[model samples]
Target: MTNSAPDVPATPEQLRRSIADRTWTSPTAGILDGYQQANLVVVPASAATEFAEYCRANPSVCPLLASSAPGDPQLTYDGCIVDVRTMVPRYRVWQNGRLAEEPFDLTPRWREDSVAFALGCSHTLDGPLRRAGIPVAVTAPPVYITSLTTRGTTRFDGAVAVSMRPVEDDLVDTAIAVTAMLPTGHGAPVHIGDPAEIGLADLASPDFGVFPGIGPNQTPVFWNCGVTPQLALAEAGLEYAATHYPGHMLVLDTVVAA
Candidate 1:
């Protein structure tokens, strides 16, 4: 879990070049180590208010790490160090309830009034969980279909998506306790039993990303996934919208504590 490369201490440029060269196509959890990685949600100006409302209604699911002003793809930062337009590894351009394209960068799809949002994800807790010797059955963050309904509105409505972590039964309590120390990362498990109870019929069939293998002694612990907003956005058929591929999150320069 401690994937700290002093050579690449989680910078925006490193991410930009990595994506440009197509050297990084998979999840981003183990790449940045302790640095927090955030999920992305890109939407048009017209739906910004409705999307904001959805985020406000379900803070834990979205967390709302940062929201850009309308017409801006770059997040508000000093000297413009963090560019949401090209930093994430991969992006999903969704329209009409389906993915239109999966691009490595936004140069081809950038537009005015497209607000980019960064939300908390379970990847923030991966370092701690792996440090505890818990064999994370989840190789990459896996989004699960949930029975929980996100507080919806006139513009968007959808079921919640949760990330699963399979922990040993005896270690579940400790795992929860450790992540609780980092509340900004959608801390703790929301559900600890069968996925069927959460409306998910199978663990192998995730709506997005690769599925993690569940071992005999492991139990799937569910946490609110940041993808919840992207799902709602996709469900609304925004005509034009982009989201970071499920596990590819932005690595922030600052540190987050519980």
Candidate 2:
């Protein structure tokens, strides 16, 4: 599932340009190795208050990175500039509790009252995980809708989503230790070993992304995923909303993890 490229941009800005110019439209996993990537979610100004609270209530799954002012596409944090309308490689437009379309650009759908939110991405820990000898899928890792729901109000209450990565039995501790230091990147594993413990029926079928190959002596490790908010947004029955395509995250100019 690797988005293999011999000329992958080396810097965050360069990578963003590649995405902006449509040179790279794949998942951001394993790209801009040390930088923090983010999940994009845009909602109308009317829903911003509840959505912000939802993120605060579910910090592990919806860690807020940068939120744009209504009608403004610019989001700057840690010296990085994210143009919400074009930074993401893919976007999912939601309407009335359903996904309306998956588009590469948001210009046509952008609204004057839209507020874009950047949620911390789990891909921020991929480098640390790999450095610790834990294998992360090259493409977007598999995500699941957990039975757990956020402590949000009626407008934002929905299932908690988690991303899965298979870790060797021996390196589970190492993976946990390494990712624990990255609070912005969903931190440590919320569940380990049994998938059914968290209501996951099969690892082969995921709510998003491709199923990772788990070898012998390896067990599935789960982390809070930024996609949690998207599920909530769908349940909220908003008139219109948008989010990054699973794994097509916004690479930022910040080192979130070692």
Candidate 3:
């Protein structure tokens, strides 16, 4: 369920401070318009190299933006200072391939051998899709795990994750065109029409976020999602791993150029 809180943060800095202050512990969707958002992933030094390669092998789903040196909580998005420990609204701690806790901060869990990665989110292209007359809503898009699996890297293996957006039939082409312009943002629709063709059994029941309905004359569009890495981490079963809670993401100072 979406947070029902009033006065949602409106600017990138305001949203970052709200998260840092622990005042808003909800998904970052619909928060700062135009600025890019990212999926967060922190892993131990031992698993960092393999994970980085995993991202490279699966660029469409995990377009890496920046990565930090081991033991560093500071990310490398030039021109902006972002503290990975607390700038994201919510974080999911993982242990032995399972979710351990959803915390507002990761200071207690940071490790000297930890390395953080910032991956581009499809949300970065929502503005262009909207301006192009495709109604890409700001609310969380429904994500589903497909039978498809990544070309397994050293220790990473799992099904692919795809987020779905229902587009009016007439605008589906426009949605594809606009989203394709942003290569870093999971460019283009991987699947356009049937959910079953992609192994999505039901639309109402999703692996993450609220299920969006497919209205008459609308088709459900699917895109590779940054959440794909979370699945790989689970399969890798590292002693410890951390990621942004699905839907909750790190708001960035960068913008997706039109």
Instruction: For each of the candidates, give the backbone clash count.
Output: 1, 0, 0
Off by over 4 Å in 3: 1-6
lDDT of each: 0.75, 0.86, 0.86
Indicate the worst ten consecutive residues by lDDT in candidate 1. Answer: 1-10
Ranking by TM-score: 3, 2, 1
Question: TM-scores of the models, in the given order?
Answer: 0.86, 0.94, 0.95
Weakest lDDT window of 10 consecutive positions for candidate 3: 1-10
Q: How do the residues 1-258 of candidate 2 rate in per-residue lDDT, one tens digit apiece?
A: 134444778788988988888877787887776888888999999999888988888788888988999999998878787788988988999999899999989989999999999888899999888877777767778889988778975489888889989889999999999988998798988889888888888889998888867889998899999888888888897999999988888998887546
lDDT of 1 at 169: 84
Off by over 4 Å in 2: 1-6
- Model 3 lDDT, full chain set: 0.86
lDDT string for model 1 (110-223, tens) is 788798887777788887777777766435767777888877756777888888877888999988888877656887787887889889998899887677778798888889
lDDT of 3 by residue, 1-258 (tens): 235454876678888888888877877666665888899999999999998898889888888989999999999785777889999878899999998998879999999999999998988877777777777778889899997888786788688999999999988888888888887778998899988888878889999888878899999999999788898888887999999988889988887775
- As a TM-score, model 1 comes out at 0.86
Between candidates 1 and 3, name the one with more favorable TM-score. 3
